[model samples]
Each structure stands twice: as C-alpha cells, then as structure tokens.
Target: MATSSNFFIHTFLISSLTFFPLSPSLADDDTDKPVVEQLVDTLSTIAGPHPGIRKNHAKGIVVLGEFTPSAEASSVSSAEHLQSASTPVTIRFSNTTGIPDIADTNPSSFPKGIAIRFQLADNSYTDIVSISVNRFPVATPEDFLGLLNAVAASGPDTPAPKPITQFLASHPAAKTFVEIEKPAPVSFATQPFYGVNAFKFINKEGEVNYGRYQIIPVNGPEYLTDEQRAAAGNNYLFEELPKRLKQNKAEFILALQLAEKGDEVNDPTMVWPETRQLVKLGTLTIESIDPNGEQFAKQTMFNPLALTDGIEASKDPILLARPSAYAISYGRRLSGQ
Candidate 1:
C-alpha cells in the first residue's frame, strides 16, 4: 500500500537540502536547459506544482522584527547593518517541501526553514537563509540534479536499494547529511536555524575570516513528542507563531562559527567543528506578524547571495547556484505557475 508520496516523504526527510552526484548517462532530455531551470523542474516533479509560491519552502509565514548588533559585530564585519544602528527586518518561517498546504506535523516538513532579510539604509538589503537541519548534502548543482533524478525515479514499486539508497551508498557526506535526525519543532520560535554556507566576513581594517551562521533561539530548541505532533492541527506551527509573538517577542542569537586555518570554506557539506570559535554577531528579535505576510511571501524572494558590503559568498557551488535557481522559481511564481 505504499505510494510515491510516501517514498518521497521518507527520502526527502533524510535531507531536504540536496542529494548525490548524478551520472551523465542518466541525464534527462531537458539537460539542454539551464541547470537552474532543471533544478526548478525537478523540484516540481518531486513536490508537485504549486502556483504563486516558491519552488522550495513554498509554505511559509512572514514576520516583522528588528536586529540589534552586538558590540563585537563591527569587529568581524564592516557591513552597515553590523554597525551601531538597529536595522528593521523581515523573517519567514517555512516547511522544507515545496507543497504549499503540507501539514505542519508531516515528517516531510520536519526540517523547517527560516529566511531573514535585514533592511538597511538607502534601500539596500541583506538576507540569511537557513534550514533547521545544519548542513547540505551535495556540493554542486549537477550532484543535486542527480540526487533529484534519483528521488524522482524512486517509487514504492522501485527495486531493492532505491536510487536514493544507492546514492547514499556512493556519497558519504550526503549519507551523513541524510542521516541527521530532524524532529518537528514545538513551534517555529522554538527551533534553531543554520546558514550552511560559508561566507567571507571583512572587518573595518579589511581582515577576512570565513565563517558560517548559527541562529540559536534565545530559549533554545524544543521539539514535540509524537503524541503532541499527531494531536496538532495542520497549520499549527504557523498559527502558533503569531499568537506567540502577541504574548512576547521571540528572540534569537545571531553568531558566526569561525573557520580555522585548513577548514573547508568552499564546501557546505564540510561542517566546522563545534570547538571552533563562535563570535556573537547580534540579536534578532521578531516582534510582530505581518498581516499582509502571505501576499508579500508570494511576491518576495530571499537570496543568500543578496549580501551587503563586508559579507561575500564563498566559492561553494551550491551557494553560487542558489540565486539562479531562486530567480527561475521567482519568475514562475509571478507567471502564476
């Protein structure tokens, strides 16, 4: 009685971020199209087409807030937002899958998402996009494309060692990425979010250090028991966020995990050790839910590469590919796909 949906849910829960390397021989006919377009297409194949929403993280709720920079923030980055002034921000919490109406309690929605946009002076903005799961699976778009193909080919009737299984066998980092436990959070405010990609942070004196972002909830992460999750409504996470904010502001510590010499800066799969130094960048206080958030969520796009001065993208291929993939999805959304 298994279904493709069931298979996808199981496989996707392993790691919503990406998959293993795909072989050229198995390339789809659409290979002629841009890889970004192919990624968008493959995501639709796996998650179904949902019009007027993002191709990934389609189901989300937007919240408004402000970011207060830490005293040490300027020591690591000269970015204007990291300076003395408080910056207004927009934050969106979402499910990993592209299915807009996916039940919040579903295992497929386990690794929740957070996208934070800081609005700076003169109409400039910077964004940080993260998932509750701390790392990414693949290094390049082609590898992710292959993983997507594997998942698309995997179904309930598929033979032993499904494509995803075989993929995990060949790719150790991806295997580890999928094996990480991801439980549903009691509420969006209760979860921690991580920026998996490394970035170059430049200080006022022009010194540079590679670091990854860790957004930890001030109260720390809290998960639901199976019984509680099952008893929760389909939109429980979203509904709970607004009500939580009304009672009091939700807060998170924004910090960077600095990479030591010889650390892998260009590979997202290579997570730096916990023993690495953590620089407290600032505090993000989410204050209110946007009444028009849903409409804004449909139209706005959050790009990790949409960075400001003092923050630059690493050469990580996955990080580099995100903007193009996001652009394709954004266009499709506007066209009512």
Candidate 2:
C-alpha cells in the first residue's frame, strides 16, 4: 500500500575475507586489532571521547516495529524475513557524529542514520544500516580513516587549505559528499534513507542481483524552512518523534534498487544511476516508541553484515570493515569506556 507516488516520480536510489570476514558475529582477531584500534582512536579524537555511547551515531533513540514483506519480495530473495510471515523489527534513528549531546540543528548531523534489525525465529536477525546521503564520502575503510584523521587535525589555526580541505581536494567523491545540501527535516519520519553499499540478493531459483536499499517515508519528505530551523530547539527532532508517533504510526516503503551490469558494486563512493530498477521488498510500520528504548539501545549493536540466508555481502572494502569497527565501539560501550 504505497502512497506518495508523485514523490517516487522525483527520485530513486560488500563481501568479506577471512581476516575481514563479512559476518557481524565475528570475534576480535589479532589481524583486525590495529585497524579497529586506529578507527576508534580517530573517532574519539574527532568527537572528544564520549564513553558508554557509540563512537558514531551516538545520539539515537530506538523503537519497536514490524515489517511485512511484499509478494514480490520472495521472488528477489529467499531470505526468511522476505517470506509471507511478518517479522518484528527494532529501529534506531540517529544524528551523525559521536557527540551524544550534539544539537539536532548542527550541520554535522545532517546526514542522519537509520539502522534496522529484523528479528526472525530462533533468536536470529538481520540489519540494514543506512544514511540520508545517497552515496558515501569514501569507498574504503582506509580512506574513511584518512578523512577522520584530517578532521581531527584541522583546528581554528590549522591555516588555509587545512588538513580536511586538502583531503577533500584530492578526494573528489568526499568533496561531493561534503558539498551535498543537507536541509533540516521536519522529523526523521519524513526523511528518506539510502544504503550506500551494495549486497547480493539471491532467490530460491538461485538467481542473483546486486542492489542497495532505499527506505522512503510513505508520507513523503517534509523539511523545515530557514526561519523555522533557526527557531527550532536543540532536541527538536528527538522531541518531535514520540509526539508524532503518539498521533499515529509512521510508515515507510522498504525497497531495493537493483544494479545493472557494469555498475560498481564494490565502491560505496560510487552512486548507481537513478534509472536502476527498484524492487518492492516490504513495508515497515513503526507503531510506537519502546519504553525501554534508551536502555536497550545502549546494549544493542546494529550490524549491517548481520545477514540471514538469501542475502550475501558484496566485496566492498568499507562494508567488510564495518562489523569490526563497530565491534570496538560496542566493546567500549559495554565496558563503560
């Protein structure tokens, strides 16, 4: 039951190695120690050491919901959640950066995040981690680390052509990402989220297709104007969410945009043509906020590679590194770092 057809008329939208396995349940290995440590260190430097919170996307609120698959979904993937039965889901919407108290109005928070955990039978689950930006700033974990290092080094007296400026100058993709217009949304419920990385969707017939996720608000996007944004409170987005949920449930269309032949399925920095095919997967209906959401979020870790059967990670370097990087953050959060 998709609405906002006119809005659809307007827009459209990684695998692993043993050392860098594509599984989220991976334990800490010696090989990944340095990379994980470096990422956590750099993020801490950028955000100034926030403990007991995520190293990134620390400012988030969790909610409980459900996902009902479309009939066409089973044709695209044999994933259990894509079957006839509806599944429960845990959703977290957050602003970017590790600053837990950062104001929702801050520019750095523009590219918001939405992480979804679909719970299946037998204590298993899968997750979809996406951001508001259509494409990522970098393709590999190394480049992302470089970007973070540059930001951490650039200060008021860092001079013209600062470290971040130099990084962006040599990295055109990152420059494009930074230059993207990020207007404030009226609420997270009104914003669309894009999965920058690609994954392989395989059906029971063994047919395969590489695609990314596009989660659209069924009510369409509505943003605050300049004057309204200027007058908004620091916690405007956070406060608006529960009240909006109180009035009625928020709904989103969960779809996948299939990649055509010759498309770069490995590099997140690359954007697929909007003309790519969009497949209906399901509808995610968020009925209410979980009373224990805050406490639960602190303990729950949402991993993109936490895949179920019928879904596989593509060979995207950034995608391969996400679980390890997130694990370090989760570890620290558990230890109250």
lDDT (CA) per prediction: 0.82, 0.79
Report the lDDT of model 1 for residue 287: 94
lDDT of 2 by residue, 102-129 (tens): 8898775657889999999878999999
| TM-score attained by model 2 | 0.87
lDDT value for candidate 1? 0.82
Q: What stretches of model 2 exceed 4 Å from their correct place?
A: 1-33, 151-163
- Which residue pairs of candidate 1 clash? none
* lDDT assessment of candidate 2: 0.79
lDDT by residue (tens digit), candidate 1, 1-337: 2475447435464326632223223445666778777667766765765777676788889999999999999999999999999999999999866788888987677578889999999898999988887888777777776665666566778887778778768988867866677777888998999888899999999999999999999989999887887799999998898889999999999999999999999988888889999999999999999889988888888889999999999999888888888888889999998
